[model samples]
Target: MTNEMDNQLAGVGGAEPAGAPSRQEDRPAEIAPTAPEPDTASSERGKSSPEQHAEDAARTNDAYSRSFPSLSEGDVVQGVVVHIDREGVLVDVGTKSEGIIRRSELSRDTSIPAEEIVSVGEKIDVYVMEAENQDGNLILSKKRADFEKAWERVQEAKEHNRTITAMVTDRVKGGLVVDLGIRGFVPASHVGTGSMKNNLERYVGQSIPLKVIEVDKERRKVVLSNKLALEEDKAHRKAETVASLVPGQTRRGVVRRLTNYGAFVDLGGIDGLLHISEMSWTRINHPSEVLKEGQEIEVVILKLDLDAGRVSLSLRENQPDPWASVADRYHVGDLVTGVVSRLVPFGAFVRLEGGIEGIIPSSELSTKKGTKSGYGIAVDSEVEAKVVDVRPEERRLVLSLKQARREEEQRRERKDVEAYQTQSGGDELRYTIGDAFRAQQQSEEGTDQEEE
Candidate 1:
């Protein structure tokens, strides 16, 4: 009989293969309730082995003391998994009674597999909701353990300003859903300056950095943002870049955005305006035609307003100036041929040999005409012009089509006389009165026919 009692006691401890048992066998076989001994002194006299009974009672009391405290409604404790069934996992939390954490309480989510979260020997923290119900089993919670762990991680990340990387699991209004074991929010603005598109779907399987902007443990709410981190880095880099910038310096930049007035160029951490006026020497009606997004170009810094944090850039300054050599290439009184390009009320614009325009006033429009319709010039017609005035400083030129022809005729006649004199002496070139009259009459006849 003594051996039988010892075996039952041995089974109570380490009964679960060298581990704590799922539950305590406290009742053992109940002793018959013989009406209390007729008297204490009589009981004592009847006890033949008083010392042995005293030791057994002492051991039983110690075992009960070592068992888990009677769990209250909100006691938290650690436990080891001794058995797992389809319904739930049974854990030995030092309580004589096993804690029955339903599968639903095992995880905040009902769909999570119990085996994946715990194993036969793995130790886990649990919360006690009931030490022993009428059914005599302790009610425990595994989800609370997981939540406590998450909260610790969140607090650590916040203190160190560390980034938490998480995968996008869902899409909700104004933001995305991220799984940090707990659902977290990543606002749309926190994606990237409000320009990130397809972010929710594209980041579904990808992990991205997040800043824990807000956390509410009781409410189990977490908010995260990636844009804040990105903007902070950009601001730091921009300040460094702006400090190093100077006027008149040239750098390579990308056209980031274009507007009607100008284009915004990305000069690393800074943005510069490449105004439409500075795009070219000629007129530019719009910035798009002159600048394209993502185009890499060399630009000169016209002005750097550090206080205002603005940079002015110019692209046309790098091109050669056409007016730089105007004076050296052309001269006053020089006979030049040009095409009539434009006509105005005051004068006609003539294009010279090298894509330059000169003005020929109405008074200078006449050719060798003797009648009222003598000047019959048409638009786009080519004409010989004399450079009467050249104002290279102002990039202006005054031309005379009529004066050029007269100068050419005088030069031809003078050349003929000089040739005759050199060959046969000047005496043979003299003309008499009748000879002059005959030449004048012939000239008149040719003029009349030309006019007709």
Candidate 2:
């Protein structure tokens, strides 16, 4: 049993196989133990390969590029102002880098600082001046964007015959500059309803309505007219006013213009001519004497010519007619005191009241000799006269200065005769001859004194 166990132990401990060489010297030359083959799969699992990393990086970059919008030069985009400085403004246009807008591209005023023109974080439209500049940044312009948008709106306005309101920025030679989102020019002739040859500057800083008359996109020129807009509005209003107007209708109006012949009153947009003759009951040399431009007044419509676009207004018709009741105020054989308004070759005109004049004929100037034909009556002098005839329809009043003086003399003579009779105590014939002789002598003396 022991021998068998020993043999088994030798076999388990790596004893040579049966029939193999028993001697140790018979073993082949021991070769150096070869290192086991490396486990390449386990090593490779420790970290990623360089090519795999490169593929991952490429994918990330492609996704980042797709996140941004495609852009091009001259394209308009909305951007937010990220930063503003003295030199320029930085805007984020959703690209890899923030876009840049130089100070000159912000506004027309180059001297203005960018910070003053734009605020940080404010979103505004921008025009891509350069999609990718040398620095790989978008170059943007605010002014150009505004100009492009403005032109589009302007063109639409012109096509639809629409009116637009714009702020007046500056006055230039022959025109004014207005901001209609873009610079628009209005010629002096089209500035206002009236001439603005020298008054265009008055509209600066004011917002006014205008009509787009002409637009040249290639030239970048736009022509506007405030006058044309006003005229169109006026014409519409005039049509309504003309339709409602009738002869003898009284209306309130504003004085618009004055001329040598008359004043033009704007009666609800319709211009009516108020002649100088119709301005007042009294005579006036000019319309300005009674009416002034821009004054509010009431007038009566005398006549209207719709086809001719003419309106005749009468200011005096709205007032009381002084001559209408002249006959009732004065009658024939009435004595009146008046001022000598004028002296002419034939007679003298005596003014009793406003627009009421009485003429003293040359034949009835005075009672005394050599005083005929109003030789002693001077203009503006006060005198008493008798009304010989009155024609209200003709506006005529004929007076006689001679009759007034003769009546006064007769009254004095009668008073003197009564006093003489009273003193004579009913003796009519006692002093008749003496009285007659005395009167004759007195008359002769008075005549001689008048001659002196």
Worst lDDT run of 10 residues, candidate 2, spans: 443-452
* Candidate 2 lDDT by residue in tens digits, 228-282: 8888888888888988999999999999999999999999878999998889876
| lDDT for model 1 | 0.78
- The number of residue pairs in model 1 that clash at the backbone is 1
lDDT of each: 0.78, 0.86
lDDT of 1 by residue, 40-86 (tens): 77776777797968877899988876774766776778899998888
Report lDDT (Cα) of residue 396, candidate 2: 85
Model number with the top lDDT: 2
